[model samples]
Target: MSSTLPVLHVGFHKCGSTTLQAALFGRHPQIDYLGEPREEPRSTEAIRLVRDSCYVEERKRIRFDPERSRALWQEALSDVAPGLVPVFSKESLTQPEFYAAPDDPNLPERLRAVVGPARIVIVTRHQIRLIESLYLFHAKGVHVEPAQQWLDARQEEMHQYRFHTVAQSFVAAFGRDNVAIFPFEDMKTDAKSFARRICDFIGVDSQHGADLIAGERRNQRVSQRYLAYSKIRKAFGLYIPIGRMMPEAMRRSFNEFVAGGREARIELPATFVAKMEDYFRDDNRKLARDWGIPVEKYGYPV
Candidate 1:
């Protein structure tokens, strides 16, 4: 309605959402990044409207209020200066469970209602590695659970990696011509190329994107040593005291000493890897063939 083309980066998290939010999208002069990244803008009302409306079931069963959500969106849109690309970014949008494999069952219709038709951007990672990284991610949380327990096969997180299913939703919700999909591997291989593609999609200058992404990775993986340390600390009820009881320098030194040297990475079992391969192969292949993605170049499940 406002003649401003909105870009929605519906992050299937563990992809490059953080970097894109904090660096690529957030820093671009021509882009108006709204609502949430790894940074403070996270708790804003723009996207919380969608999150609250879409995920909250109790209200839905009673009586969903679409106008309330629309008001929040309209308010956010009012502040956007003309000629700047508006980007609503939140990786958790795709994963309603906050941080898990199973994506939101419903396409984000409430958000779509705000901006009649908007361009969508989706980024996906290799299933096996994505799951592995997720395990490592959760392991560092205050309560570290066993890898298997953290994974919780019952969640069927692997299915979320079927990239096509996720991407196609955006394609359907926004037009086929409006949805852009990028493989996470590309960012790993050529950050510049990846930056250019996204910048191109959002109709912004690509040059600045390159400079913004230099060594910018929020939520860097914790060291493998943290897995056991987190659990032991949780067991001892040490999730408090605000890191006091010792001098600042001594605490910093002690923490550095305990952290493992290598980045923490969960090693998936062979059987699990095989299962992931079987599950994602056809989906990935179809996605590549249809979307013209050079997925094989990255040795993805396909």
Candidate 2:
């Protein structure tokens, strides 16, 4: 048996991570894709603490102890099976708090300590699309705020869209040779090919390509009508009580009624798109210059 090389997928969420997780988990014999470290007790307690700390909205409230985290990591990986590469994936690792340079408070350093030297994979989406998707995601979770209002409230926290800064931190901690960046656009354009590339990156067999490609699409957007209904329900703070009272079947029927046999597409305002492009222009340029990513592929102004 050969030794395992740990690979971490620190996600910039809503960037096809769910699909990638579904593809890699148990599909390949050579890789052990652990979806979230906190889900299993085999992970070190320190690692769990670090993961949970980054997993919340109020990350500033969470404190980390590095010495304890390192000790726990050593114990956790001490018995990892030989010849199988361990893949740890979690989207929260890309949160903005972790990238707030100089003031990052060593969050990224703690992550490196827990994981040791490992391959870091990050998937990024166009900022505009990502923000819109994020808004819809919150709406689904009963957040009633309008898009602009919600974005304004959380703008500073949405630094996952600032790819260059996030990438630089990871690269600085983990080494540039150890990191790989793939655009989410690639996944949407050719999922099979994208899966193949990722499989190669993690030293998995591409024979599982069919299984990887077959993974179901997750977090599909709800129709605009359904989203609007969710917003209204949330605004009234009625979804909770109504949800409790409604039978599962009734809830499904209600969804179907709102969907009206097809999902309604939510269109973004052109002005908002233009603003996002301008906001992210410099960061995207840095990504192009430093990481050699084709910013044009994301439709960013170069």
Candidate 3:
């Protein structure tokens, strides 16, 4: 622990977070990045604590110990070089509950306590696309919920996707100058510039790792066969890890028979998108007016 930490990239998921973590931050020679286990090569105890602690289980919010988190962070910083700026990135930091008006907003405050006023970076995308992509992301796993129900549940959490609200909360916690927001659309359009901008903001060398993060679209494609198989698993009340038990040969044959190689054309209904646009119009208008960002050009509702 030589100096105060610099940046915290608290994510609004379904953004290019995985690619940024795996390719840009993970590979950057100067930045000392810490986050999830598999996504980060240098998964320290501090990150595990952050990821494990903040969540709701069985209608109860899990507690996060600021002192313990700081202690673990101190221990984790032992390996970092004196001059390197330590960056903590976890896309799920602003957990789903934070968006609800009545819920206690402890994550940002807890983070302030643990790290003490660091720069906060929020990377988000268009609301309709964000929700649609999120549904597909869950479809990859044991999630068998009907897409309509899943999307409808999330539509209620409009504050989460408002982008400006979440950004302003961090700005409230950590001073105005410390918060920066960017669109994931920029990364998709120009990977090099997008990576460079973030690297520059974080005070790291941007020239080194831009190309590594190009063209990364993670888990947006849903498999039709898997959707059917997953529903059947749900029908039988099997929520456990039963996929491993299926014989590899049988799995391969089933995939061939079902033509699971083809990506399913899953899409959100136009009415849902229109509702989201109408809901977020005012918020997006405010975001553009305050931030001077051309959100409309990137398909955001203005």
Candidate 4:
């Protein structure tokens, strides 16, 4: 409450980041939203910098240049919100190599310069479902291989990523008191309370955007058929506007077919699930100890 606010929603993406951003940051009267929806190679510029110069050679070069990225990020915020507290949401902020060395001379200082004394909110999901949704999301565009195949081939790479390291980085930069960790599942069910917590964090009143939260998760499901259809449409020029021209019943049938065929239970197979769980176990444990976030809140037994 002492000064202006900036809350960075460094995401463990596909954890309803879109819905939460839509309701809280996207439409909030007090918050300004940044970043492009459906932007791939998310935080592309920042990732490139991290990969090329900052990261070790053994590490994959899939990161951005944080300094330039945040400069542009802040510029985007200045353009959009003018005088308000800026709320930036980007899933790429959780990248392990990027966050691991917060004490490093270069990156952390750049982060501190852009969003001074910012409150960092990290939204995470159960690992099993999170990775699965991510696989589907990748299928939508980011990947050519099927979900299972990506898992099989990239298991070590995926598992080696210590996403929870971002929590430590934020705590190191902004202090533990400024960090708010929440389960995306809970946020989906009780957005008002979640929003209130965030409002309190940013020193904004809940009434600033309480009414706008009503339709938060309206687009929660996408059927596999629709995803496939979308890919076909993209190839053949059957766009959404064209789909809108079709009879409503026909569109509904198409959507339903995708939902029926593509939707899978969030549960993953045992070995695949175990690999992810074992990989993050220590990182999550360290996060809990450092930040007092309950290990149980992570949706897997520690």
Give the best candidate by TM-score. Answer: 1
**Candidate 2 C-alpha lDDT tens digits along 27-65:** 567776555523435453565578656534564446666
Ranking by TM-score: 1, 2, 3, 4
Query: What ranking emerges by lDDT with the best candidate at the front?
Result: 1, 3, 2, 4
Q: Give candidate 2's total backbone clashes.
A: 1
> Per-residue lDDT tens digits of candidate 1, residues 83-191?
8888888776776342233334344555566566788898988777778788877666677676666656434545667778777666666778898888888888888
**Model 4 over residues 243-294: C-alpha lDDT tens digits?**
5777999978755666676464334567877767787788777657765656
Please estimate how well model 2 matches the true structure, expressed as its whole-model Cα lDDT.
0.70
lDDT against the true structure, per candidate, is: 0.72, 0.70, 0.71, 0.60
TM-score against truth, every candidate: 0.85, 0.83, 0.79, 0.70
Please give the lDDT score for candidate 3.
0.71
**lDDT score for residue 179 of model 1:** 88
lDDT at 73 for candidate 1?
A: 69
Q: Alpha-carbon error at 159 in model 3, in Å?
A: 2.6
What is the Å distance of residue 275 in model 4 from its true position? 2.7
Give, for candidate 3, the lowest lDDT window spanning 10 residues. 36-45
Error of 2 at 190 (Å): 0.7
Candidate 2: lDDT of 43? 50
Worst 10 residues of 2 by lDDT: 35-44
